[model samples]
Structure formats: structure tokens, C-alpha cells
Target: MAVDVEAPGLTPVHRELSRAYVEWLTPQDRQPFRPHVTLMNKATVEEAKAALAELGAGWSAFDSHSPALLLWRYLGGPWESVRRFPFTGRAG
Candidate 1:
């Protein structure tokens, strides 16, 4: 599932923090950064579109919120492989 930024209660701080975090990343690291929350993984494009359409139709709008920071082990060796950044959020 995709996190809708257009969700009714989104705050400007959310946008700013995302922007700042992206800006702080190196060019290569920046490539994977997109303002989204993934609810499922490894779906084909067609399946993804169908799921998204269903979600949109069901939820006319979404509640505004920021995702909490989550840490996971990188499957591909070191954390640096995924690009490192100084944490910059309340939980950090």
C-alpha cells in the first residue's frame, strides 16, 4: 500500500522533515528515498495498481500522520550498503 501524502491532516512539518532528510543524503543514497509507506512488497505492477485502486476507492481520505522510524538488518551485508544517515527524528 502507498501512504497518501494528500491525507487530510498532514502537517507541514512532515513535508519539511522528509525534505531535510532527503537533502542530507548523498546522491547515491537519495535514489531509494521516496515519501511513501509500503504496506506490501514484491507485487507485480498490475497487481500493485489493482491494490492501489481498491485502497483508494475504499478510503476516500486518510488520517494525517508520520511513520515512526523502523530499523531492519540489511540483507546485503553492511548497513552502509543501504547508505547511512544521521537519524533526525523524535525517536532518533
Candidate 2:
């Protein structure tokens, strides 16, 4: 699954937090870690498309809400650690 953040005018605190996350990760483990809130994960292209369609149908029904911090962990061979502050907010 792919995620994205749509914060146009980020506060300094948010920016600093993002920077800190990148700095904390090793170079090989770094990607463009943008601040975002992931609502769901779809396994297939069809599933993703269906989810997008549903989101579009009900997009305007929900009120805006402030973002929050989320932490995640990745477990695998030769690499097992926790990733704190994985997301801050969702893209519109």
C-alpha cells in the first residue's frame, strides 16, 4: 500500500519531527517518509480502486479532524525494530 501526506503549510514542530524521523533511520532504510495517516491497507489493485471509490462517494460526509501521532514496528530477519511516529495526518 502507498500513503501520502497533504499538509501544505506545516508547522515547524511537524517539520522538525519529520526530519528527526529520517535522521533516526539508517540511510539504507530511508524513504521519502512524509507525514500521513493511513486509514486502511488494500492488498490488490482492485481492492485499492474499490476503496478509493468508496472514499470518493462518502468524502464530503465526514468533518475534518486534527491529526495524531502513530507508531509502527517492522519485524524481519536481520532487521527488527520499532518505528515511532510513523504518521501524523491523512491526505485529503
Candidate 3:
């Protein structure tokens, strides 16, 4: 689920936004952010490794767009969607 964040200004914008909530971030979150999308979680090591291998075998570069920003809150066991901020600007 590694991502190459190509969106212009995204990295800088993430840093700027993250700074405001630095006090709440964990040690891992405090480190440099490597943006990625998780396709599967809560899986066994073998299952995850197999899935990754299968996915990588058929993977190809693709272009995708972000239509909105989803704000989520981790409630211990599950994540809750707090808000959605739709991008009104023109897409690249």
C-alpha cells in the first residue's frame, strides 16, 4: 500500500496541517509521513504477505484523484468518520 504522493503541495500542506495537532500525535506519527492507503488490516502475517504478493504481481501504475478529504477519529477498536471536506477546486 505504498503511495507516491505526486499531488503538488500535498506534502507541504500535510506538514502544515499536522503541526497544529502535533501534541496529539504518536511517536510514529511525529516521524516523516509516508502517505499510503491501507487495503487490508487485521490480517495474519501469512495472509498479508500472500495478499501483497498477489497484488504486486498484477499491479500497474494508475492515476487517481481525490474528490474529498475524509476526517476520521480512531475510537480504540474502530474508526469513526468525523467529517468530509470536498475539494471544490478543478482537478488536474
Candidate 4:
């Protein structure tokens, strides 16, 4: 499965955080930092394309800001939410 890296959502802060995390993992298990939101896993390219097309018809883009980071751990199959790190920066 592959993820499509889009802009705005893939901000500078996220890139930095991803870089830090990838460094902790082996190159075989992890890859160079690529910003994207995972739509689905283990999907065929044709299926993904169809889904993207269908989704785009009714999709509306909106402004967003990263407020927190969620950490999840995979047990055997399902992932469990472990922690959340909220961004705490003063506005100028």
C-alpha cells in the first residue's frame, strides 16, 4: 500500500517530527520521510485510484492546523492509541 503526500497537512513541523522518528527505525522497516495521510492499507493501485476519484467528487478542501500528535501501538492486528502530544507554542 502507498500513501499520497499532500500539502498543507504535510507541514514543516510534521516533516521534522517524521525525520526524528524514522531515524530511530531501521532503513529496511522505514523509508526516507514522506509526508502523507494514509487512506487505506494493502490496496491495489486501481482500487486506490477509483477511491480517490470518487472521494474527490464530493471532497472540499479546508484550512487546518496541527494541534497534536497521536501515538499508536500495534499489538498483533489492531492498533491501540497510546498517547497524544498537543502542540504548545505561543502566538506572536
The model with the greatest lDDT is 3
TM-score of 4: 0.60
Worst 10 residues of 3 by lDDT: 1-10
Task: For residue 51, give model 4's deviation from the true position in Å.
Answer: 1.1
Query: Whole-model lDDT, candidate 3?
Result: 0.77
- By TM-score, the better pick of 3 and 4 is 3
Runs of candidate 3 exceeding 4 Å displacement: 1-5, 90-92
Each prediction's number of clashing residue pairs: 0, 1, 0, 0
lDDT of 1: 0.57
Stretches of model 1 off by over 4 angstroms after superposition: 6-28, 64-68, 77-92
lDDT of 4 by residue, 2-38 (tens): 4445665446765666667865765644655566567
**Best-performing candidate as measured by TM-score:** 3
lDDT minimum window of 10 residues, candidate 2: 61-70
lDDT of 2 by residue, 19-83 (tens): 77766777644655465556665457887788878776766533354454445555653444454
Least accurate stretch of 10 residues (summed lDDT) in model 4? 1-10
TM-score of 1: 0.41
Native-structure RMSD, model 4? 4.0
TM-score of each: 0.41, 0.44, 0.77, 0.60
